[model samples]
Target: MLAEERMAIILEIINEQKAVKLSQLCEMLDASISTVRRDINSLADMGKIVKVHGGAMALDDNFSFIEHNVEEKLALFTEEKIAIAKYAASLIEYGDFVYIDAGTTTEKMIDFIPQKDVSFVTNGFTHAKKLAQRGFKVYIPGGEVKFVTEAIIGAECVMTLKSYNFTKCFIGANGISVSAGFSTPDVREARVKTAAIDGSRKAYVLSDHSKFDKITSATFIPLNRATIITDKLLDKKYTEYTSVKEVL
Candidate 1:
């Protein structure tokens, strides 16, 4: 595509979502980082956009937000997600009270998890249903569903988490930055994830390698907060600061 055409598409996406990440733009435009960077720089110079840490923001936007629904997320990093989920599932033992956070990865964990004396508490509608179908004990919080991710989150969700404790919690994140920490796109969902992490004795974050170095809009958990289970941990800094287990 022409540089002008690519820039116009980038503007459309950023304006629609208030922001667009470089990784996402690369996928959308089928362009390289260098090409996307050049387009972004040109747009910023023309005052058509504003450059941010890992992406660009709309000129008319007051804040930046880039998010995806369940369908969009389910397709990316399929192999890595499966490996991470498999590793996370291995940590579960009999009679353990587990908390499963909502995400494409954490949702897959239910499939690999053993059918032992395990009970689950979750904020995901899809997760709850899947766990039930798999004949596992499942508890769901009472909250308004966030249709964007098919996850439940609100004050009620937080309240439900307060009453239950978990032996281990497996969660997901949109971004994991050493400085900014684990984050998602929405603040409401972040609260649920924070509560889950706080309530668990052993908390594990299930993420792909792509999540590393990215910083999303909402900050939920700090770096070194939870042991991360991923397909690969390329950065030595992650291990220097906290525990990161590689599955691939």
Candidate 2:
């Protein structure tokens, strides 16, 4: 096939799958790895898609609309996220008060939270509901709900968070970079996460390796403030500023 025809097929695949790994694309197109890489790079430069490590993801405008599309996002890295969540949950003792941030990775941590006398604070409506149902002392911050991420944010939420201190905070970010620190797509959510980190004694960032080296708008917190808990594939630079625990 011509280069344009192969590139067109690649775009169609990414649009249908939302994400495609480099190796998979090469196999699908019956092309050399180098040729496929060039196609991905060219397409990325053209603003047709976003290139992630080892793969490319379709540029969906509603990327932050996670609440309405939890299933789709969850399927992206099911096992890696589960491993990270399990490792993070292990850090929480039975009586520890924890702050959980809003994101798909943080939501997975809910499954690992043991049924104990733990005080859990959150800005995520779905997380708050699940934790409350699980019989933990869950507090949902008072604020306007952002429909995109189904997270409660605003001045009221920040004020409510100030009332309680936490033993640990498990925050999630849309992107993590050595240069940019931690970031999120929405400014309001970033504010909420910043408050959570400040209110906790020890902060833990739970994200998959996919988030590493990526950058998004709105800086939430500095990399120095928290220990990063992520998959083993994270870049070495992340280890420079904070303690990193790689979940196998």
Best by TM-score: 1
Model 2 scores a C-alpha lDDT of 0.82
Candidate 1, backbone clash total: 0
Worst 10-residue lDDT window for candidate 1 reads: 56-65
List the candidates' TM-scores in order: 0.75, 0.71
lDDT of 2 by residue, 96-211 (tens): 98999877888888888877778988888999988888888887889998876778999999888888889999998877776457777677778888888888999999888877
For candidate 2, list the clashing residue pairs, or say none: none
lDDT of 1 by residue, 54-119 (tens): 677666422336788889999999999999998899899999999999889999898899889999
Model 1 segments more than 4 A misplaced: 1-64
Clashing pairs in 1: none
